[model samples]
Target: MKTLPSQLTPFVRSDAVGALLAETLGHPDAEFTLSALGRLTGVSGPVVHREVTRLVDAAVLQDRMEGRNRLVRANPEHPLYAPMREIIAATYGPVPVLRAAFDGVDGAEHVYIYGSWAARRGGEAGPFPNDVDVLVVGDVPRRTLSAIAGEASDQLAVPVNITRASREDWDAAEPPPFLRTVRSRPFVDVMTGAVHGG
Candidate 1:
């Protein structure tokens, strides 16, 4: 892993770091090395190593050595992973709700509710859960996506982000608004780059 230079920002031990890493692991197939992990967490290599080791010991992350590289992944069953990913995505920018907000009719393709609050907010607030972050991307219509975003917000009973863009936007832009914003943060850049035409 490259030793992060002083010019880089520090990763704070907060929802952003946790959520970004959590979301990165949303797919079991997601893989990365220490340098990648450092960028994802918005932390230096040493900080990431310490946090990852702690998570591994706590059973929140499972670690493997891929040659000289150390790989880390979230334990899928961890109660916090899903919500955390959504929250991290949401914190950086708006995510489309299941509704197609992008369409004139308020229809949407898929919406992922994420973050700590995405895990623990249920009307009766006993605990001060984190914000309800989200990621929305799919074939759903714009209007419909917008309309449903309100309902989804009410259902989650928390701040909901909507990431909605035209297919053309996602296919052509090197860093769509969402991806660029996600990468522009001081502490986290969960998405390293945009998939041109996936």
Candidate 2:
């Protein structure tokens, strides 16, 4: 797994730890098995285990054995819970937030996060991105998409820009200049963690 830049998640020992924390703390009420978290974060099992062990030791996470599977969740009682949640929410919340907001909107065929945010998430070295750029390829109305983007912006404390395109345009026989650019660059699928391009 590629290491997350320290600037992407300051104060974390490694990118794996930051990602693991994002999955666990981002959904405080949810409990995840270590293997599940490993898959979610794209971290290997041993790395996930090591990081979870560290967090458990520090009381940032609570873990228990359920037969053979270990379930882990954020410790609400941890003094750093709120602050850490805030940090993770600001740094790594966009994926889950946008995914939840636009995953299965009627008439939508694909949702992508492009531009600097996606580039950084794909492990590029750069300054922090101030806004998130999203491309929707489907028949969803622009007004509805704008409203969703507005809500997601508030939740993420960042501007969420929406670019709408019809499925026809997306699958054009001759792709537009803009589509060519988007296709050549790194972007993340909101419903899936797939990253395309560099």
Candidate 3:
């Protein structure tokens, strides 16, 4: 998995840990078992278990036994809960939200966030990106992509622009100029697992 930017490294252990924190701590209502979190963040179960143990020891997370499984959630009562949530929100919020937004969208093979926001996340110095640019590669319908983007925009408090391309277009041996440019820039894959170094 790709490592988070340097600025986020002190607070975030790894991309998987950040994703787990973002999903659980960032959203009070969200809860997950170790396996579920692994599935969501694309982290292995052993890794998720280790991270969860650390967070639980630090009082950042609370885990309870439920039948054959352990259900984990953020500890809202922790003194640092609010601030920690804010940090996770600022750094990793878009990912889970985007994942949720496009969860069931048919024919979406890969989803990536490109352009300014992605660049900023990749550690380039600049003013914060105002809007998010999304590239959806698959055979999804434009209207469906638009609707998903609209919902994500409202949820993230940022404008979202979506661009679609077919699998063939995205994987063409000699891709078009736009595809080449997109592939050349920094990007964050929000679906089908993360790819490091854009």
Candidate 4:
């Protein structure tokens, strides 16, 4: 499976690092303390602290001591600020947002994001992705999936296209041509289970 940039580099390998970068650097209007960041990222406080220190040293983030608590925010003045934000948005932003959108929806065995955005995130060079293609595997209702997709689209600020497949179809020894083709491409597993081709 083709992996994300964060998985390929020591500098951005940690989940906390990617989460912190995407949430703070990608959304400059937000600020967070270490504990809050840990909670948001589902990472431990010490891990968040280490990543924050690294980002602070790299000038990607700025930290201020607010009495006993330290608050962190993106460093807009940094030379790499804009580029870094774009990178984080492209690489780390979608999965988490999409995963959250699917959290309340029942009956989905797996959710995988494929096509353009996934391709780009997998290191294929291309124009900036304008749409997100999602493949939903299981017995989920089309209406429910569409609603979730609509919600995710609004939350992610990008158009979301959904494709549905039954678990039997997805897990077949030889999937149909379309499913085979989609599985052959790079994709990100939004839910926990391992995606067939990812």
Candidate 5:
């Protein structure tokens, strides 16, 4: 897996820094080990450790010894913590935010993000995406998805558009044209954090 695009964090040296910040700052109350953060952000272990150490050295993150494991968490007391957290929430916050929104929603089997936002996260160069496009594969009702999208939009500060497709249509020998296009470009699995296509 690749890191997020540099545009996501203008001051950071690598996109991995932004991603690690998203995990830590985005969930301020939670503590994570280096390897756990790596898994969640799709970053490799060495990079996760290096970036985390840098943050800790800069006082952006706080870490403590926990037996043989090192536990890391956001340092809310840092002067830049609030503003940096807000920036991360608006940019990299969609994955966890939307995943939480759709949790246990009946009939929503698979959720994906496509279009410009996904492309940018996949490291493609482009203008900042103004909205998020979601594809839900299952039998969920439109009204339900619309409501979810609305709330997600409010949380993310970006418009969220959700389109649902039946399992039959999604898995068809000849998928719908829309599915074909979505599968031909960069899209992300909301649950697994996997990137597919370009």
Candidate 6:
């Protein structure tokens, strides 16, 4: 099968350097250059510059040359960067998981969390082999779902099981989508966050 596209328009998206740049954009800030931002975010310098430019165009950041160095600052209360940062964290930090899921779903749009792993503090237990149960909230493209399930199995070093759930069906429970009891140790860990590992 064809590999999927890398870029995605997620609920929250960030320029790779978004966090590093934000740290310096505020007043009374510490010094940070493109090189510094790259190092901080683990992205390359050129990538940081390009993303910074986009942020500037969106009026989220301001930039100028300050005697042989480019200086950047968050546009005073731009209403964009702050929220952008939050959105990026909520949206992107889970990306390693989400991306794995997305790959499994192969571009299917209707996946959501149902079990303990969905909890903010994580599930009742820590990460475990059986806690990785995932329910596809909508019709996941078979290929994507397969890919994500495989990645989760391999990279997470845990076993993950996939279930199909319609929007109405998945949300019917107290937790909203976990109607079935967990079976595998892998799945149990996923729900409990007991899988304890990436």
- Best prediction by lDDT: 5
Candidate 4 has a TM-score of: 0.63
The deviation in Å at residue 88 for candidate 6 is: 4.0
User: What tens-digit string does per-residue lDDT give for candidate 4 at 61-170?
Assistant: 99999899999999999997887777776656777677777886778888898887766545566776788999999878989888888988886678899999988888
Candidate 6 residue 27 C-alpha distance from true site, Å: 8.2
Q: Give the poorly placed runs of model 6, Cα more than 4 Å off.
A: 1-31, 89-198
TM-scores of the models, in the given order? 0.40, 0.84, 0.78, 0.63, 0.89, 0.36
Ten-residue stretch with the least lDDT total in model 3: 1-10
Which lDDT value does model 6 have at 172? 57
lDDT (10s digit) by residue, model 1, range 8-62: 1123254334433543454456766768765534456676677677777867677
RMSD, every candidate, angstroms? 10.7, 2.5, 3.1, 6.0, 2.0, 15.5
Error of 1 at 93 (Å): 9.4
Write model 3 residue lDDT over 27-116, tens digit each, in one string.
687678888887766667777888899999999999999898999999999998988888777666787788778888889898888887
Q: Please estimate how well model 2 matches the true structure, expressed as its whole-model Cα lDDT.
A: 0.83
TM-score of decoy 2 = 0.84
For candidate 6, the per-residue lDDT at 57 reads 84
The numbered model that scores best in TM-score is: 5
What is the Cα-based TM-score of model 1?
0.40
Task: Report the lDDT of model 3 for residue 174.
Answer: 89
- lDDT of each candidate versus the true structure: 0.46, 0.83, 0.78, 0.74, 0.86, 0.46
The true-versus-predicted C-alpha distance at residue 146 of model 6, in Å, is 39
Better of 1 and 4 by TM-score: 4
Give residue 3's error in model 4 in angstroms: 8.2
Ranking of candidates on TM-score, top first? 5, 2, 3, 4, 1, 6
